[model samples]
Target: MSHAPDLGSSAAPGAGAGQREGLGELFSSVTEDLSTLVRQEIALAKAEATQSGKRAGKGAGLLAGAGVSGHFVLLFLSVAAWWGLGEVIGRGWSALVVAAVWAVVAAVLAVRGRSELRAVRGLPDTTSTLQKVPSALKGHEEENHR
Candidate 1:
């Protein structure tokens, strides 16, 4: 059941002087418990969101870094190929082969990254909180073993 914050704090009960102190203590305890519960829920939300963000960030960083590094590698390879071709096959054929190879590399990385990206897309990463709950309760190290 959803907590009605106001209901728990106000409109409970208070009697005469003796009961007043007792009631105040009771209310204070309840309030503390409620506050702790709410804080825990909020912390869980933040932790889960952070985890989901890191997952995407890592994936994106890898994809972008690999994409750039792959392109650079291709550039160097093409230059080397062109230089070699110029010595043997001449400029025109070297340019054509380099362009063709570059196109092939681009298409391959696009296809691969697109496929990997699709896996992570549209996942309700927020609900990952549910999965994390058990682990979060168990402590971080214990969670990893599980």
Candidate 2:
């Protein structure tokens, strides 16, 4: 009579070798899954960064266009004012008056801009949160192990 190896029985030497092979397959599967997850996360981060950069670039371009348009408007208005003043006073005095008005406006803007820049501080809260990241990760790892 021939005997068949019982599937559930591990008493046979061949069964032990088969179990080791199964463990090796499980380990390889886990490694592959982990590698795939890391690659997907990196791709997501890169896509997000690229999208943000594009948005920032578009906004900057729009801002530059607005600034140029505003400059042209200001230039036309200044010339019109100078010509209108020239019709009443002499051309030389009208030019001097326009120059003085622009200088005063420039001074006021510079002062305001300086004060506003001084008010802006560094990102204290974000810096504090980033400093705690390592400890937070370590605690999370401990919780997961438990």
Q: Pick the candidate with the highest lDDT.
A: 1
For model 2, the run of ten residues with the poorest summed lDDT: 137-146
Model 2 over residues 17-78: C-alpha lDDT tens digits?
Answer: 88999999988986786677557656655666666556555555545554554565567567
What lDDT score belongs to each candidate, Candidate 1 first? 0.62, 0.58
Off-target runs (Cα >4 Å) in candidate 1 are: 1-15, 73-81, 84-146
Candidate 1 clash pair list = none
- Deviation of model 2 at 11, angstroms: 5.3
Q: lDDT tens string, model 1, 64-139? A: 7557756766776777676776676676456657666666666666566555655554335445445565565445
Steric overlap count per candidate: 0, 0
Worst 10 residues of 1 by lDDT: 121-130
